[model samples]
Target: MPRPQKVRKILCPPAMSGFSPYGIPATDSEPIIMTFEEFESIKLVNYEKMPQEEAALLMQISRPTFTRIYNRALNIIGIAFVEARSIQIEGGNCEFEREWFRCTRCFKLIEGLENHSKCTDCPHFEKNELTRLNPDIKDRIA
Candidate 1:
């Protein structure tokens, strides 16, 4: 049997769940699903200007694996851009360094529950308004 996939370590979840082309209703086409690890690869290598080897070390993966993930992310993004399709960011064999939450009202990412109260600046800030980005992995594994 093949070796089990390693769980990638991600700093945090993406600020937004997904993206869509302007003027086009997302219902026009099926959304492309991009895993969290793929998003992290793009963020580290492209957005942060991090080298592939360095990013691999940061994510605790081999350079070749990191390159594959980065290339896949680029290709998915390219297809989404060219085809006017929506891109959804979710689902990966990864664990976040810390718990993350997002305020649905203002769409602000809150790093931790302790800081949730600080999101009072959001017009509709409420305890219930916070959605946990990193649910317990055990629940998902089963």
Candidate 2:
């Protein structure tokens, strides 16, 4: 049996939701979906200029797994650049490493730390359990 996919940890959501090629009819082709994990891998390896092993550790992934993910990201990016295809980065098996939470009732991702740590969208927010904020979080940063 295949192992359950681990949720890759992302520091933050992408600033831009997606990218598309100009001068082409939107209906001419469908946008390719790049997983959010792939985007994070690209940011870690290329944008951050971090070593693969170190980046892997930060993402809580094995070095080999990180390499594979990095290679796939590069391939997809190459395809988009070469073909001028629209690139839509969306779904991935992932969890946020930053201050965010998925509300159980509404299944909405929300910023928890800065926003009072309760999901405003949830109907049963009074009952829904939130992930605890670190009391020493500020100290750790300093």
Candidate 3:
């Protein structure tokens, strides 16, 4: 049997779940699924202007693997743009370094529950509006 895949280390979750082209209905086309690792690869290399070798080290993956992931992310985004399809970020063999939460009202990412507070900028904000992004990885393993 093939060896099990290593879980990639993601620094944090994406602020938003997905994206779609303006003036196009989401139902018009099937969404492209971009994994968390793929997103990280793009963020590290493209967004952060990080070198491939350094980004690989940050993700605890090899440079070659990081390249492949980054390429895939670019392809997905290109297709999404050309086809006017939504890009959904989810589902990867990855583990986050910390718990993350999002304020539904303003879509602000919070590091942890202890740090979660009402989003002052959001009207009608409530503590209960904070949504946890990552479930405990240990729980999934067990």
Top model by TM-score, which number? Answer: 1
Off by over 4 Å in 2: 98-110, 113-142
Per residue, candidate 3 scores C-alpha lDDT tens digits across 2-113 of: 6656668899999888898999977889999999899989998889999999999998988888888899999999999888999998878788888777888788888865
Rank by TM-score, descending? 1, 3, 2
Q: Which ten residues in a row have the lowest lDDT in candidate 3?
A: 133-142
Better of 2 and 3 by lDDT: 3
**Model 2 lDDT tens row, 7-96:** 666787665556888888777777888877888899987899999998888888788888888898888888887888888877666666
Name the weakest run of 10 consecutive residues (lDDT summed) in model 2. Answer: 133-142
| Candidates' RMSD to native | 2.6, 9.0, 2.6
Top lDDT: which candidate number? 1
Candidates in order have lDDT scores of 0.85, 0.71, 0.83
For every model in order, what is the number of clashing pairs? 0, 0, 0
